[model samples]
Target: MSTVKDVSKDSLHSTEKVADTDSSGTSSIHGAEAAVFEKRVWWKLDLSVLGVITMFYLLSWLDRTNLGNARVAGLQKDLKLTNDQYSIALTVTFVPYIIAELPSNLLLKVVGPDRLLPTLLTLWGIVTTLQGVIHNYAGLLACRFFLGLLEGGVLPGLVLYLSLFYPREHLQKRVSAVFASSSLAGAFSGLLAAGIMEMSGKGGRPGWAWIFILEGLFTVIFGVFTFFVLPSSPSRCSLLSEKEKEYVIQRLREDGAISKDDRADAFSWGEVLRAFQLPQVWFSLFIFFFHGTILYSLSYFAPSIIQGLGYTANQAQLMSVPPYAAAFVCTLVLSYIADKYHCRGAVVMFCGTCCVVGFAMFLSSHNHAVQYGSLFLTLSGINTGAPTITTWTANNTAPHVRRASAIAVVCMFTNIGGILSTWLLGSLSAPPRYTKATAVLLAFAVGLTLFAAINTAYLYYQNKKKAEIRATITKEDEPAGLGDRSAWFEYIL
Candidate 1:
């Protein structure tokens, strides 16, 4: 709820110097009041866009994970799938995800997400509905692959879209809200799937098939409506006044790594090369890949895993609800703490530790009650860890094309891990003792903690060096190449 003016005024009064230029072009404070006013205006506009974006993210997730629900309703049996066929279906989705990210993000920039995103949502929804009619693995594979291809760029493209709308400091909490909606989807999937499972007598098709038909239809309908409701950017939004649009643009420039008009030209390969040069991009990819593996394995398979524990099919579907509810609560709580403290890396480390402990609990017991309890911990940790890492990575990038390129690159790597995870957690594998899967996930957790720690340490080192460089040069003598940018551009870690 805090305004940009609130932060700017506070910064002005604080000991840290506010950037300014005197007649000789040396650092000094000049007209702080006008600066604060411009900033406050921008903050309000950004928040409105963020609110709409949150709804888009929530629907995007519901569309993606409904397949998990279908799996529970006899999707496998009806298609006459072999044991490995389900894995093929999952792996096929990632192929499009890995291939389409960069191109789709570029397309969003030109066509505008307002037009492109809804088009994608509707197309994928139709594909999802068609999934219910697949008579064999080949049919299911085609649907799943196209579904992945269609939905592939939405997540990263939206992030790039949002970067054009808000300052870096204000970004994390909003990104967290969008990411947390995934947890909400997990909860909603269980509740909706439970009802659909019980509707077996309503239609000749299995209850699981109806789940896809209805959910996909709903998404397609919403997509048609959202195309009209969503805005292209702050400058085009009717929700803000002309004055407010200028303010939002100014505030983002002040806090962002790049200037507001940096992307005014057509898309260029230079931005892509620049993003690829940053070490953080590679680190982000590795971290996302591991977290993606953990998240998808649990998200897609938890109900089946629960069913394996000697519960009836309906009971298994019903039981998926509570852990996801807990996951949703944990996600919001953890995101709030991260934003409040502005401590991204530490939170990820904590989540990594939680994953380790949770998996250990799963490994130690096969009791239905104990395993159920452990699932809450596992789902919460893995889901929370993924968002925290992604939100952190997003905050580190510059504005415009570089941000889009970095996001596409990160998503490209992470989804490959999704393919790995689907195969790693096998449908044919016996229940209650998926020791191999658990062990693989556990190794990932430890790797995550180690990698996050390394990134954090590297950030600390970079900050120290920047401070040293600032200390060595006075305002008048500062090098002109890097311009007047402050040493305050800290990495999210």
Candidate 2:
């Protein structure tokens, strides 16, 4: 098999554009040789790039969702917080988290992910550890707000980060891999919280406090380590030889859109505005908003829901593990299928259906075991659909800054749902089941199902109308003001 080193520099840097501008941009670089070299590059990235992104996401999710675990571990009781106050604490985190995401993503290219991602992780880790030591509601709100501010950039930053290395078609699975960490985060928090609870009376702190301290400290340490190891970009990754680096850069050029090295284009307010103009961006925002309502509810309330199952606090912590565990696996599988089929909406809608069915069961059934069982489906669906929504938006938006703005906007809507869930649904009494909250989440699920199909059809139309225009376009025309709307590009259908 031909290797990356064997490819001539002339072929690697070929000026000739491929006849088919829709795919890779390299005209002379094709067939078994290029294919073999590309796989070698991907395998390296799977280790150095995809692996780190996934690990960082895992740490982030643990810190973000551990609030649910801590709640059951007695955070509220120790703080002497009322339901409204506790909800306020939850709601505060998302406020800064939502508002700052756009600017955060825009800064990713300027600041670079290697520095920006790890810096955010370390700061948030410090904040998370502070959650362990707080004595009053004011302290709690401070920690939560800063935590959100630091963390707001992470998910969108990471999603934007992936587009730097991989082609658009390969995005759904990679995005899924990172988000699956959130499901794993849910499971790990429960198991870790269960163990941390054993340290309850030790160090004169409760189990909930220990949960934050230990998890946060570990994150700080890992964040420091990641800074030295995480590669900056395909262009700067030290693992690749010069030829391999060129191959990697050439790969992105072939896929179209501003490759990492070519991102020197001056940022434009007009390009940023375009992200808001696209109908698909609105569809993606709504999908994220509606889908996030149920997901955030599950992340924040799963332990409480399990506790409502007549289980002890410890048992509730342990039981919350299963639904997230199921979600972790299903997220990987479903997104892989979605990427492979290039039919992302089918998988998204199917997952949304899982949520609708799960929520329907929650509202209709009075049985505790059945309600608990429905959580597996509920969480799995919610987690499964998240990455698809992200990739759908990222795939269509272009040039670095615009995609950044679009992704950040999508994240804002996700947290808007979080605020709604925390303030409205979570404040309700849980005695006999939260019939009202379940009904509301069910409506959001139905909305997700309908809109995934709508966005899919709409993208199909956009691609069809653009196909003929695309056929007449060349590589030189791509950098014009049209951005991703440049005929050199087509929306993923």
lDDT scores in order: 0.75, 0.83
- RMSD (Å) of each candidate, 1 decimal: 5.0, 4.9
- List candidate 2 segments past 4 Å from native: 1-34, 259-264, 471-479
Best by lDDT: 2
The alpha-carbon lDDT assigned to residue 318 of candidate 2 equals: 94
Q: Candidate 2: give its CA RMSD in angstroms.
A: 4.9
